[model samples]
Target: MNAGRDAQAAATERALARAHGLANAFLASLAERAVSRAPSPDEMAAALDEPLPETGSDPAAVVDEWFERAERGITASPGPRFFGFVTGGVTPAALAGDWLASAIDQNAGLWASSPAAAQTELVVLRWLKELFGLPVEWAGALTSGATMANLVGLIAARQWAGRRLGFDAAAEGLAGHSPIVVVASTEIHLSAVKCLGTLGLGRKQVRKASAPGGSVDIAALATLLRDIDGPVIIVGNAAEVNSGHFDDIAALADLRDSHPGGAWLHVDGAFGLFASASPRLAHLTRGIERADSVASDAHKWLNVPYDSGFAFVRDGAILREAFAASGAYVVGSGGWDPFTHVPEMSRRFRGLAAWCALKAFGREGYRALVERCVDHAAAFARWVEATPDVELMNPAPLNIVCFRIVREGCGKAATDELNRLAVRAIQEDGRAFVTGTIWNGQAAIRAAFDNWQTTLDDVAMLQAAVKDVATSLTP
Candidate 1:
């Protein structure tokens, strides 16, 4: 019986190895293909129709069949042209690290369970803090994504604010506490509001401060704060998702100094915080260090795989108090456990990929890549400006360029329709995909340069494709 079990284990490992090889090959090919393509409904249904086996089957055969069927259904978000969202293409080092992480199968929840995993996380966090110019003493936790990071950051903010008001909100809950006011710019990400609501703070409890050019107007924010009663938590954006516009962090920090007892300031820099790596763009995020807490995503700009986000706090004690839970079954010592700092238990070794990527690229390598993307975006913007038929929509502040198709005689609605039709045509006919977005109440095409593979030649190709599609759409 022991021999038979050993043989089965060997077979399973072989099958898993084969499956991993196939997945890697598929992902590599996808990186070279168009970013967006959906399989037909019939193909999806057929893939889902396979019956579950009642008896044991060859694992290699099962994995092969599934991969063959599902390959067509996968969207190439990891490809260079996928610009619909602020998604980052995984770096080669990070992808390899992810594969190794899965093979290791380590749960990095506590130091006692997996000391290596915990140490790796600690090293990565320290490296990140140095790279991003954060305080050396700041504590951070790896989370699933920006949503969870924001949630965790805001939880600490709420706790700190409540404590100042002489209420133990974290311990006793918000039962009899005065309503807390959460302030954010009108351009604040919707996830912030969702997080507040999840914490039992009503959506109406959030006050919207007017912003111009996708940043919070500091004067407007101060005026609103003056009238608000009770404790407040001010949420600021490091980067606006739509236009890549950065808020004036220095000015906001100055405002924070004036209101010492009134509010707590948290910076939500999901994608924008990474800009600090680029000397050219670092000025845009000036004064970010003054923030009480910051939340950012590695998946967005660090080129790590999905589900890698982080929340950093200047006050580690507050973070621990906000999230730590004790249980009889769980062993506890005077050691660090990740669950004490974030909203997760049984977490995977997600920080491994990030550590690998950071180590492999080093700080200078990443800074060069970020600066290249910014330059490419500027070039694309210049190309659009040079072309009479293409009108630049917003300032190319980072790696994103927003523009629209414009003709001499076309009306606004007609121009919008033409741009939409052009996007669809380019996706379908040219096998090059780009997406459209509404910018400042006008329809525009947005192309974000995030992938390392993207270059000036690729930008020229995209420009040509746009022109071809627009010409074809002309009546």
Candidate 2:
């Protein structure tokens, strides 16, 4: 048994060395690599789908096969010019930390399981709170992404409302209880909407009020607040997804204070919360500190690896109660046990990447990153404004510029069709990418920038690509 174990360890070492070399090779050519690749072939699929062999292959051979199969099929979403979905590319420090975390394989659910993971998470949470100007005392959990983070906040809101109605929500759900009223702008993120639906709250039932200029109308919100008698959940969107426009968060917090139903403000900051880290952009996130709960995605704007998000709840005990579980075997140290506050109890060590990012890029480094990306957006928007065949659909308030292709004498229908075809064409062209979105009822294209590695040259290349593809598609 000892001999076999030694052999397996030796094999793993060889595999790790080979994987390291292959990863370096792949990353070195990321800038020149195709931003998008076609779907995998049937032959490649069948080659990978064969039955399991009685004698397994060596680890080094397995690693080689894995890369050989995956290299061509992979999409360079981490490339500098991938302006889709507001996804940020992995930074060097964060990637290193992620690899180490994977190697350690720590279950970050309990301090007993991994004290380093738990403490690193706690320290990282504190640092984030300080960076974002959130209250330092709030309880936070590292989640998979903003979707789960939003769910964490909404779960707490649901439980708080249930308790106010004189029942145990975590113990017994709201089956017979009154449904809590949720209020938000018409532009509430799809992730937060999904959270509401998952928590038994009706999605269509959310009361929405949009101002004439596409923000939430404070007057309309006030009227809705006065009508509700029970607990209410108000979502203050730090940044709207389509155009990256920030809602009046400070104004929303003030309005939430006036809600007759005793509102719980849950801010889905996602990528936008990073604005608070910048001295120049901190004004965008004013009054986020007073929110009952807030959600953010490090992977979106912090330039960390994928699957890093945070949920901060003002009431720590309430957060724990909302998702509490107990077991005789799953013992926890007296320190902070992450499983108490999050939905999952068997989560991996996600905090290491975030901690490494914060440590490597201190306050100044982060400030520069946030400001640089915003500048890139502004510069790209200028390019869009200078061009004739594009219409700026929604203003670029932060890092997302929403525009659509415009043809002379063509109506909205024609422009929409042209933009739809342009999305596919640009993906096929492979120089750059901009995602599709509907802005104010018109099909539009969004150039959302977040990757740290993106430079002015990439942005310029993207501009040329857009003009070439979009103009060719039009008249």
Candidate 3:
């Protein structure tokens, strides 16, 4: 039996090696293109459908067949031209670490179960804290993404706030406690409200504050805080998703200091938190360190693969008390038990990918890469400003540039249709890809520069394509 198992393992490794090579080649091909061809429903069903095996077959053959069928259907979101969402291209070191993590298949619930994983996570967390200028003693946990990280941070805030009001909300539910009001900017991510709903706090329970340039309106926020009767949790944006605008953290922290009733401040810095790493952009995120809690995504500006998010809290004891599970099954005394900090019992070894990326790139290397992307975005914005048939929609604050294709002698509806048609043409053309969004109730095109593989030449090509499409549409 041991011999058979060893043979199967070796075969599986061989198959994986071959699959990796093919996948890398496919990714390389996408550098010169925009969007990948979408697979039809029939193609997807055929690739995913399988029968239960009555008898074991060769693992090598099975792996090969799986890749062959699935490769064409896979979305090239990892490619250079995928700029629709707030997604970042994964670094090679991180991808390789993910491969090793899958091979280890360790459940990083506690140190005893996977000491190496726990230690690595601790190291990564410390490194990240230092990188972002967070308090060294603060506690953090690896989460799936910003959504889960926000959920965890908000849970901690809720617990800490509940304690001040003489209630153990975690132990005894929020049955009789005053309703907790969550205050955030109008441009805040929808995930915050979703988190409230998941926590049994109604979505409508949040008080929306007006924002200027996507940052929280300090005046509006102060008014909301004064008007609210019960405990309040102030949610601030580090980088507004729509325009990459940052909130005035310094001013917000000052308000927190003067408020009579204690208010928990949570910074939702999913992709914006990393701006602190760049000396050029660090000033934009001033006072981020003063946040009571911060949630960021390692998969975004950190350039790590997916399933990497972090939640940092100033009070370690609060996080452990709020999230720690106690029962007959759980072991009491051990090195760091991740389940004590985050809401997960069986989590993958996510720390490996983050640690590997940091070790391979070093701090300066990532900072330089991010700076380059920002420069590219600024140059693209300048190009849009220069073009006759293009109109700049918003100031390119970070890496996202919003603009629209100008239609000659066309009405608002016609111009809107032209912009929509232009984006579709770029995707269908496959040389460049961009998506459209409504900005200030006007349709506009957005080109996000987050991929490390993207270059000035690619940007120029995309700009030229947009011009060609717009020129063709003119009557």
Candidate 4:
């Protein structure tokens, strides 16, 4: 038995070493590698899928085979020129911390299981709050990503709305809370709506106020609030996904405070909240501090490893009231358990990556990163502006540039097809990757600049690739 155990331990060590080598090899090749490849379905299954083995295989062999078989199949979003979906590349410090977290394998659900994990999260939370100028008294916890963050923020908002209506929403279903309206601008992220639906608020309960230039029309929103007599939760978009336009958060907070029936203000600041890091761009997220609950993703702007975000609620008790799981074994010691604040109980030590990211890149470093990305976006926008074939669809306020291809005499349908073909052609060329979106009833290209590795040179490459793809397009 001792001999078998020793052999297994050796295999594990070898497997880990192999992983390290493969990881570094991939990172070194990212600069010159293709941005993405369409993985062949049959090939993928043949490589990754297999019948269950009665016995076990060599650990190192398994790792080696998987790495070799799946390398080209993986999307190289970490590459500098692969601009799509507001994705961020993993920073060195964050990658190291993530590896360490996996090695530690701590369950951060309860403080008893991992005091270090809990403390690390607490430290990270403090740093993030201070960076965003949020009140220190606010309660928060790390989550899987922006989706879960939205859920947490909306859950607290639901509980707060329930209290105002004299009901315990978590204990009792949302019965008789007819039309608990969720008022948001047209620019609200879909995650917020999904969270509302998850919390028993129907999707129809969402009443969208008019938003001009992707920012909430405060007057129209106030009018909508006055029309609604029931409980309300107002959601603000810190950064509109397509245009990177910021809603007037201060005005939204003012409306929330002034509403006759109190409104729980939640801000979805997935990548946009990082604007607060830069002194010059702080005004974009000016009133974020006043939001009742705020959700943001570290993976988007902090350049941390995947699966890291946080949701902060102004009131601790309300947050606890939303997701306070209980059990005989879950005796959360040391007066605090991460599970009390969020939905998950079996949680990974995600704080490790975030804590290391914040430490490695202090406030100044983050500011520089944000400024650089914003500048890159502006540069790309300038290219679009100068090119006659490309029409700049939206203002490049922060980092996203929405543009579309133009045909002199083509109708809407032909123009849309042209835009689609152009996007597909560019993607297939694979010099740079960008996603297509339908902007204001027309097809357009959305280039989101978020990765820390992306430089001015990468932006230039994207511009060249786009122009080449456009010029190569046949009538």
Name the top lDDT candidate. 4
Candidates sorted by TM-score, descending order?
4, 2, 3, 1
lDDT of each: 0.82, 0.87, 0.83, 0.88
Extract clashing residue pairs from model 2: none
Q: Which lDDT value does model 4 have at 356? A: 89
The Cα RMSD in angstroms, rounded to one decimal, for candidate 4 relative to the true structure is 1.5
TM-scores of the candidates are: 0.93, 0.96, 0.94, 0.97
Query: Candidate 3 lDDT, tens digit per residue, 76-118?
Result: 6777767666778888889889989998899988888899999
Task: List all candidate RMSDs to the true structure.
Answer: 2.3, 1.7, 2.2, 1.5
- Candidate 2 least-lDDT 10 residues: 38-47
**Tens digits of per-residue lDDT for model 4, 131-193:** 888899899999988889999999998888888888888888788765567999887788877
Candidate 2 vs 4: which has more TM-score? 4
lDDT of 2 at 299: 89
Which residue ranges in model 1 land beyond 4 Å of their true spot?
Answer: 40-46, 49-56
lDDT of 4 at 245: 94
Per-residue CA lDDT of candidate 2, range 1-475, in tens?
6998998899889999999998898888889987876554775585566677889888889889988877666778777989988899998999999999999999998898889999999999999998888888899999999999999999998888888778878899778878778999888899999999998887888998885445678788888888889888899788888888788888888887887667899999999999999989888888889899999898888888888899999998888888888889976678888999899988979899999989999989889988899999999998888898877776787898888888889887888898888887887788887789887788888888899899999999889888888768853
In lDDT terms, how accurate is model 4?
0.88
Ranking by lDDT: 4, 2, 3, 1
> Model 1 compared with the native: what TM-score?
0.93
